[model samples]
Target: MRRRKLSPEERDLWSRVAATTQAIHPVRPAPPDDLPAPQSTPKQKPPPPKPDLRDFRIGQSAPGFVLRQDLAPPLSERLAAGPVRMDRKAHQKMTRGRLEPEGRIDLHGMTLAQAHPELIRFILNAQSAGKRLVLVITGKGKRGLDEGPIPQRQGALRHQVPHWLHLPPLAAAVLQVTPAHQKHGGSGAYYVYMRRNR
Candidate 1:
């Protein structure tokens, strides 16, 4: 391919750039090659001097990296503003139990220690089985508690189950964790979104 020569305007612009680059930083003399080597008890080199603010003139080429804004696409073309790619409406549908769950696990009557491992197993299996939305029944906690210094939380599993879903072992397989619809288990249950096994 034949290379195109710069227009007169471009030549003038580059000439100005070259002139300013040289003017801002006068050339420094190099140390002589025959200079004696430093002693074993080496003196610490002084820190580099601060930049001369005047040398930071606009349009001066920087030492390392520069983002080429001129080459970038227009804002409208780059952004393509619209609804986010994530289908939030569909996610809402799943959370509302409008979509049928692929699997269900009832964790009622189980202690927290027992329920934690069971929850992990259920999610892992569901993901491997290619299940997306699964219902976990945690049972709505008791309302009234005996008055004490520290009142116990109502629902153990309901609160703790969500935390377990975010843990490393289960976080990979799970996506969104939302309360189940009235039909599934309502506040007592949750709809666990699982990632597809690849």
Candidate 2:
């Protein structure tokens, strides 16, 4: 059926009537005060005043809240800055010679020139292969039997290895450099703990 267009006055009146029309609440008989609540699902308790601790998801029946990772401190600041000491358990185990190294590199005969580069390469390779604990054997130098014209120092690599590990290139990968446990070579070697590769 064709509809007729309304005059301006009729349109204004109709708009006013529509604007005045309020949504009406549906009416239903209330349940008796003693009637049990619906059993299809349990009522949810209101969430605690504070948000839950972790970001874990809850069961389908319940809702979960995501903790704000964006509001957290930046990674550089959050991390313990320079070098992370081995966690207590690992430190204890390592100090006691219980935790064995995943890999080891011996600089028994390499010169200072050779040892530095080799040390860097060894650490990088270990980190790439996902080895966290490793041994770096820098053998203790032999003592001179006779007093030479020039006095020589013993354990050059032993002293230098610690310094090299602290340098920038290897420093980022190396977590800690410590004296090797007795079973690993004692004073002649070092235990290098590497950070997880990102």
Task: Give all candidate RMSDs, comma-separated.
Answer: 24.7, 22.1
- Model 1 residue 61 CA deviation in Å: 82
Model 1 scores a C-alpha lDDT of: 0.75
lDDT for residue 9 in candidate 2, whole number 0-100: 100
> What pairs collide in candidate 1?
none
Q: Please give the lDDT score at residue 86 for candidate 1.
A: 30
lDDT of 2 by residue, 1-198 (tens): 999999999999999999988769857777888997666877899976996675656563434432322354432233324454779788768867898899999998888999998988889999999999999999887754434444445667876888788888998998877777788998788888899999
Q: What would the per-residue lDDT of candidate 1 be over residues 1-198, giving only the tens digit for each residue?
A: 999999999999999988776456867777688997555886899999997765577888656532333354432233223232335887768755689998899998899999988988889999999988889998987755434545456677776887788788998997777777788877788877777689
Candidate 1 Cα outliers beyond 4 Å, as residue runs:
1-86, 143-148
